[model samples]
Target: MTSIASTSQAPPLVLTVAGSDSGGGAGIQADLKTMLALGVHGMSVVAAVTAQNSLGVQGYWELPPEAVRAQLDSVLSDIGVHAIKTGMLASTVLVETVAEALAGCDAPVVVDPVGVSKHGDALLAPEAVDAVRSALLPVATVVTPNLFEVEQLTGVKVVDETGMREAAEAVLALGPRWALIKGGHLPGEPADLLSDGEREYRFTAPRHDNRHTHGTGCTLASAIASHLAMGDDVPAAAEKAKEYVTGAIAAGFPLGAGIGPVDHGWRQRA
Candidate 1:
């Protein structure tokens, strides 16, 4: 019998395609960190560059479409990602290219249709909204959008569980296989709903008084992608991700003058 030692390799590789966060709180930085913390190999393709921090996003510049496509081809042809999470792709051209590039790939995708930064600055461009809706969402395995993003994408406001149910349906109608509607902006306990156009799940956590709840959406999407790459199903991934983000929020740290980011290395430091 052959030992097969020549065929062995490490765990699955997870890729994060998004923007650069100079502050390292969210975007590619946070995604990579979350993947590392979860014991997975992390890779990144920066689609845009942002001078961002806990205070706010100061400025941004989208990468050329050809550059984005070249990066995607390079990664997909060689590294062969197990799962991919897309964050701030800033423009319609980049979004369309990313959607097309991942169209034939077999890996699952967690789409965090990020609109505004943790500090309330717009991340995606006006022309990109249509691209995200028509191109990207259809390709995503699981699309995670917060309340504002839900409204931005579907024109539905999630004020409560009932509203969330409606909002989830509206989001699912946009073409994703599954929709995870984050309800953190709603008053009261931290709540979110995950739906598959058939079954609906509610994830709720005790509202923490901590004002340091930045990078949460990015963290949750990355956690989900990591779990999926580790072989968890959509519901299972959602459960694990919810648990991870809950702990992250509970252990979130203050970094600047305004809202802080979720501590991706919380478990490591503890």
Candidate 2:
């Protein structure tokens, strides 16, 4: 018999505390896919479950606070994590639960304040918005919010590229170390602003004509966390993540009856 050889090296580990998307376009599914594509080991703590598809989210149900806490403890206690990412925490209890668990964590955290689905379906509860602001945002190393989420969290409505700086400031005031304000919704080229109160970095990409960008938010946040786990600074991670997401968006292909997902494996294809 031939002897098998094995290596001792292991990839960085990234944990995603979020919801599960049945359609496999966003939430935990997208997070894990992004992690894998970026060469990280992906772990998950499902905070909610959604009946979602290309068209819209029909409904969602959050897990009990105790269950969510248990998952977090189980993952953090034994396997450990190099970084963490969060998305679509559906309720106030779950938001508070996850925040409490991550309060003293040493690893970097990426928070995607997901307010609505791609089809305009509500993902985060309106009442839970306060919990996300008071509890969740404070624990984030970096918070990535789209225009709608920026307004939902800070009442800062960003209508153009110029307003992104103000939006980043408003999110930073909520206690995150850095804020990444996504300006994809604005007309013209898609631009995103990253700031840490003092220095600022703007990332812009020519708008792809594709509309199948269902998992862009989750994918970008997860990619940032994966890069952070691999020892990149916040700004460098954001830059690389933006590049990866832009390629994925450009390679997006339609699925189901409506919007589709960005190709998580685009790098591999290229």
Please give each candidate's TM-score: 0.95, 0.98
lDDT of 1 by residue, 20-51 (tens): 99988889988998999898999988899999
lDDT of 2 by residue, 14-88 (tens): 999999999998999999999999999999999999998998999999899999999999999999999999998
Error of 2 at 142 (Å): 0.4
- The lDDT, on a scale of 0 to 1, for candidate 2 is 0.95
Clashes in model 2: which pairs?
none
The per-model lDDT (C-alpha) reads 0.90, 0.95
RMSD of each: 3.3, 1.0
Q: In model 2, which range of ten residues has the least summed lDDT?
A: 3-12
Which residue runs does candidate 2 get wrong by more than 4 Å?
Answer: 1-5
